[model samples]
Target chain A: MAERCAIVGIGQTHHTARRDDVSIAGLLREAALRALDDAGLDWPDVDAVVIGKAPDMFEGVMMPELYLADALGAVGKPMLRVHTAGSVGGSTAIVAASLIQAGIHERVLTVAFEKQSESNAMWALTVKTPLQAAVVAGAGGYFAPLVRGYMQRSGAPEDTGIRVAVKDRANALKNPYAHIRDPNLTFDAIAGSPMLWDPIRFHETCPSSDGACAMVLTSERAIPRPKLAPAWVHSMAMRSEPTQFAGQEKINPVSGQMCAKEVYSKAGITDPRREIDAAEIYVPFSWFEPMWMENLGFAEVGQGWKMTYEGATALDGDLPVNCSGGVLSSNPIGASGMLRFAEAAMQVRGQAGEHQVDGAKIALGHAYGGGSQFFSMWIVGSARP
Target chain B: MADEAKPVTNIKTPMRLEYRYSAGVATSRFLRGIGQGKILGQRCPSCRKVYVPPRGSCPRCAVPTVEEVELSDEGTITTFAIVRVPSENIDVPLPFASVHVLLDGCDIPFFSVVQECPVDQIRIGMRVQAVWVPKEELTSTLQSIRYFKPTGEPDVPFEKLKEFL
Candidate 1:
């Protein structure tokens, strides 16, 4: 278990489909330097670095950390690469926290990113295993079927997915660092857009992006001096199971349920829906908002769709989710999970300007990956855990 | 319409990406087992759990699976996906089914494909058996089973194969 860790710094690139202006190393440094600046620290203050991503094939680069050591200022420092599929970003952050919690390092810099401009995401996902039939065409392709399943099971109104896309995009307009900021976005355009997979539409899908998210985590003693106001890390948790099994509930996976329960217990929260003021959840597709609402115990099973319909998950709702647009607006696969974790910290630190939840006391940072089997969540509070 | 109906030489810039990974010790052992025409699984001493497509340790117990077992190539299809996309290490016709096959004598199911049949006929609980590659072509992989085919027997009862879930 980690002793105790706090997030002192957070930074992320302006997400977009193409970042032709910089190399993969340059992109990572852009986010890292800004985070160090935010924390009021220099390179030497960082003792180690942890990097993460969805897969190496996404950029056609293998073990990329070895090539990016110098750019990230991690050549002389220990660097670890984490890949728990999409949850890798959150796991990388947790690994950094563990180092601080374990009394091994006072300060650890964690960064996760993906340069999707270099290769087609569709092609990367289709990389074959011998004799194994391929069903996934791309991120959108693999998830489309799941979205259809969600709609079928929940009987959620067709307007619900459209509403989620519109709401998150509207929120993105307030986040300067968000990848896609089209103020012209509206519900009708989303509803009228081509349906890529039955219930999911093109406008409703997350954009393939090139961006990075970074954070500087420190031990208890490392805080209280020389940095911008820091958000104390209250607690963190991760859990996983096989990708699929018969009788496995993919929509609201049991592993996600256990992970949430473990995290809340460690954080000492009796009622998350009331105790936590806000949240930033992973929602690459619009349907996940309701699915996660139930999985996180914010609402009952099969009633997650009710939260969205009742305006409980909206921006001005009781608990605003993904105020920074989330994966729904700017999805840089590797960095997306961290962005949720970082955005949650931004809320507690009061750094979130327009999208702030207004004096958030405690918040939930959630991320899941690999057919919804891997879950990494944290409960962060303004007050110490 | 002319271009759409054009010949094979009329195409353009195609998308191609490949990954080359080091088959670390665990993968090496798995493939070597295939090369020898044997199905080997790693067993966790502490939990006594067996993992096919063997890994270094039990994911749950986080302890090493140092023991080995040779499993049978016959099992039932648990669930599957039909492939319509072409990719590396596989060259099959469109609309082929990829099924999770629980090999006989193994505790868990590993991924494999079924051939010598139509896609619509592939069903869960279908009895399928492995068809091995020629010995010289074998490597450390589940690919040692060239493809699974219907055993042409009465389908296995759901109650007998319920543990796969």
Candidate 2:
């Protein structure tokens, strides 16, 4: 049997398009130090370190973990670097938790960061390869068709995507660390925005942000008595499939569904929509909220859009999703997923500050990457199981 | 401190990488066929699904696809997006239809641009045929198909192509 793990502390940087004042090392250290401070611990207290990021192309820096090890207090200790496209953050956290759950380490530190201002993500993603057509512009170009397919199959209203953007932006105002905080964001503002990829409008897209997120996971035996509760790791799961295959389901990938099913089963969740009090899911494009709502088994097929239209995903709704403003408000590619995971832990720990869900005892963190083929999710709760 | 003596927060470092990419045996054959005004696909022996611009092996079955199959230039647009944003890679004019066309006899959709039609008019299940470059200018590259154009055929029902989407 695996030992229990608890998230004792979580920290994140103030996300923005540019963090010009700090180098990559400095940016990561800021978040790591905050997490260490929140945990009431020092650098030497951590037994191991784990770091994650999207790709070297996003920042034009290869093998950054080797140099960042020292900055993250990994000297003479085990250090690991995780790369799963955009899901690396969630995967990294899971790896770090495994060290504690396996009883190998007393405490571990995990960090994820993306300095997108150093390079262009669009060009990095659309790099031309031999014998392959370069018709896809960026992530949006590749996913827009799938979104169109989802709209057609579900008969969702044209403004459904815009409504998601409006809600997330409104929620961003409450999150101090959110990158894009708009005080006057309206459905008209999002709907009137120029369409970038037909159905995906400008406001509906996630901004390229430079940020970092860090967390400290410790074994149950090493848990510190802090002011706020520690979020106990209830269940974690990851699943992956080929990026493209004949008859593959891209709109709602099976990998996401299977990953969610495994996680819910382990957590003993029969009805996730009711059991999970809060959720922080990766939604780089606004529409992914509903798309993932169905993939995560929170709604029926072709009816996920109804949750968004009915305000069931709002902050005060039954299951508040992305109360930390989500990817649409602050997307530091590599760190985006970990932000979701950390926000979920925050909700369960009652440390979410302004965006805290009232009496949120259970929370879900979800992320998908690489054409929705890669998925990593976790369930966190206030009480240890 | 004087303004001129302030620290430099940003620097310009432009870099470029160049490498030769070798197309595998299966992809080379497809590229060579397209140069001769032909669209070639390969069939997975196990699943029997034909893949356009074959990737040398079937992703699901993880087996080499040896059998070659010829596909029709015309196909149905399973899904599409009208790109209005400018990209450094694409040279087409702003606001063009980028479609995923499920070609005849092929199991998967081939991504390509559709031209010679209004962006607004492009819809799912629309029939389209590839427009190759001049014969003398053909090359062993997907760019040989300048773009796909409308064939004016009746649109395929969405139910028939939903699986490809």
Candidate 3:
């Protein structure tokens, strides 16, 4: 059996389209320092550092972690780098937590980031396969058809996407560090926004941001600190699948379902939708909110949009989702998943300033990347499991 | 300490990977624009977000930036890098300027080549104009704007371009 690991600290950079003020090293340092500060420990307290991100090509840098090692204070310590496409951020965090869970390290710092300003994501993601001769365009192009497919199959109304956009932006308003905090935004504005991928609108998509997210994971013995309450790691799990395969369900992906199942089981959860008080989900596109709802067992596959339609995910709803605005508000591709993970910890620790789910005791953080091939999830609670 | 005194034999493996990409249709248009003496951007009808090297959809709004807007040949340098050494795959000249320029009238700024000046002279918030190539050399990519040169105007105050940071 694996050892128990709990998250004692978390940090993230103010996400934006461009972080021109700092170099890649400078960005990582900013997040690491914050995590160290939150843990009430210095760089010397960290046993190891794990860096993860989407693709190196996005930043025009090759294996950037090698150059960033010293800046992250990992000069003489063991370091590992992870890449699992879009879900890389969450997978990276799980790997660092595993080190503590395995009794290898008492405190591990895991960080993930993306500098999209360095290169156009549409260009980097537009890979030309030899036999595939489709001018299908960027990431939005590839996912649009699938999103359309979900709408048609689920009979979800066109306004469902608008609701998600408004919901996430409103949640972003509470997060002071969130990018593009527009208090004047409304459902009308989101619905009236230009439609990029037919059913998908402008506000429904995630921004190409520059950001870094980090956390300090510690073993059971390392905890029991006096400064602040720590969010105990109840369960953590990850799953992956190939990019494409015949007859595979991309919208309600099986990998995501499996990841959640494993986590709920490990954490002794029976009814996730009710048992979990809050959730921070990765919704790069607004439509993903409902699609993931069904995949995560929040509702039946076709009935996922019903959950959003009834406003069940609102701040005052039964299960508030994306209370920190989520990726729809700020997305640094690599750091997006870690942001979900950290946001969940923030809730359990009573650190969520404005978006706090009132008296919340349990929550979930989820992230998925690529053509929905990768998945990482965790369950955190105020009391130790 | 005792293990340090013993002779050790180890094996090493050499591994390498390379990413080769083509300038697609949109990139071709931008590069073609660079080849010529013009700058181009695509406006999203859905959200009105103008994308440099104009592509299909805006990542934020999920709307196709369809309107091809011809921008002024001038802008400001937000940040830049003086390429002293490049990787094996690089085919450009050394000491070249890779600068992000805020295209005229556009909300978001983009990267462009800086030329017709010394590498040491470039500074953030510097007002510079695009130096275009002959019309015959035009392509449909960002390369259309050959590079930015010194505008001879004073540098914009730090507070002025703080948002670009």
Candidate 4:
């Protein structure tokens, strides 16, 4: 049987469009050192390192873990690299937790980062490849059609995405590390933004950011020495499906459904809406929050967007979502998933600073990548599992 | 019914792409060295292993490879592949040897074309040397080394070459 694992340390960089002050190595060290400091430990205390990012091409670095090993104190220690597209951050954390859970290591440090300033995110993601159809309009153009499909299927109003944009951006005001913090942002500002893709406004999209997130996971024995109350791992799960197939459901993917089912089952959660105190979900385009809600079983199909309209997902709502701004506010691509996971842990530990969800005990962290196919999620709680 | 039962067809789409990739600090130095007809490699201070195409940090030691080491042009061929099938991008003639040469004083092998020798005679552990283009034609590109030719020296021992392969 696997040993119990708990998150003892969490740290993130102050996300921004351009972190020109530091090189790629310096950027990663900023986050890793913070995590080690938070754990009250040094590089010597880490047994292994697992790192993740969106794509090597994004930073113009091929297998950056090779170059970042020293910055992370991974010299002479086992280091594993993970790249499952957007969900890589959460997957990297899961891999670290697995090491502790397998009794292979007492402590494992996991990190995910993206230096988008080093290269262009749009061109890197949409670079044309041999034999593939030419759909090189970047992520917003590609997903806008599917968003339209979701609206048609659910008959949802036109302002759902805008509402999500406003809510998440407002939440970002409380988060100092968020990349896009416009204190004067309003619902009309979002609605009035230019339409980048039909039915998708420019303000509703996530900004390209350069940042990193790191977490120090340890065996249950290390919990007593933690600086703050530990966020216990209730359950962890991942799921993937092929990129495309005829008649496949893209709006509400079966892979996301299956992944949520596995995580909820492992965590002994039946009613997710009631059981999950807060959620830090991947909502890069704003509308994905509600779409994922339906896919993750938080709400019935066609009704997820209503939660936003009724303010059920606000900071003071019954189920607060993206309380630390979320990807909509600060999306560092590769680190976006771990940021979600870290925010959820912060909520449970009451260490989220100004954005802390009041009295949050149990929370969900969700991330999806690669055309909504790849999924990784974990549930954390204040109390031990 | 016949129309629906017909076999599916493939769509052919050609794409023209452009990108300006950054070589970063370590690689920029290596590229500059190639322009000067000098081959450079980085040595890991902790492990002492040298890396061709010098990276900013070493993968094994996880430390910066700031120490520069000049590599000898003469080396041993650790392994190779004989290419026969052709593609639009394949410039070498059919049945030519694409070789992995472990340059003398360097720990890792780098890929290069092996010319001036028959593909059948290009065996592993064979001694070879880099062939550079005309001095005036030299650029920062790896293409500066046109190919590698047999050094006509004694074959390196398999025991010494096994780790590289």
Best by DockQ: 2
Q: What is the DockQ of each candidate?
A: 0.09, 0.78, 0.02, 0.01
What's the TM-score of each model vs. the native? 0.75, 0.98, 0.70, 0.70
Model 2 clashing residue pairs (backbone): none
lDDT (Cα, tens digit) per residue for candidate 1, span A162-184: 88888899999989988889987
- When sorted by DockQ, best at the front, the candidate numbers are 2, 1, 3, 4
**Residues B1-165, model 1: lDDT tens digits:** 366665553223344656666666765687788889987888767767667777677766666667888888888886555655444435656656666677876766776678998977876678999899898887666656778999987887755654454
Q: Give per-residue CA lDDT, model 2, range A1-385, as digits (tens).
A: 9999999989999999999999999999999998888888889999999999998888887889998888888999999999999899999999999999899999999999999999988978888887566899899999999999999999999898998999899889999999999977798889899999989999999999999999999999898765577999999999999988898999989999999999999999999999999999999999888899899999999999999999999999998999999999999999999999999999999999889999999999988889899999999999998
Instruction: State the lDDT of candidate 4 residue by residue for A1-385, as single tens digits.
Output: 8898999888899999999788888888889888888888889999999999998888776799999999889999999999999999999999999999999999999999998988778768876543212322567755665676577567788899988988899999999999999976799899988766555688989999999999999999865376887898999999998664323467898899999999999999999999999999999898888898898898899899999888989999989999898999998999999999999998999999888988999999999999888999999999999
Better of 1 and 2 by lDDT: 2
| Model 1 error, position B110 (Å) | 12
What would the per-residue lDDT of candidate 2 be over residues B1-165, giving only the tens digit for each residue?
Answer: 548878778887788888998998888999999889899999999999999879888998999998999999999999999999998788889899999999999999999999999998999999999999899998989989989999999999999988887
lDDT string, candidate 4, B1-165, tens digits? 447876654333334447666777888788778878888889888878888878677765567879999999899986565544332333566656666678998877766778999777986778999899888987776767888999899998766764453
- A65, model 3: CA deviation in Å? 1.2
Worst 10 residues of 4 chain B by lDDT: B8-17
**By DockQ thresholds, what CAPRI class is model 1?**
incorrect
**Chain A vs native chain A, TM-score per candidate:** 0.97, 0.99, 0.97, 0.98
Poorest stretch of ten by lDDT in candidate 4 chain A? A128-137
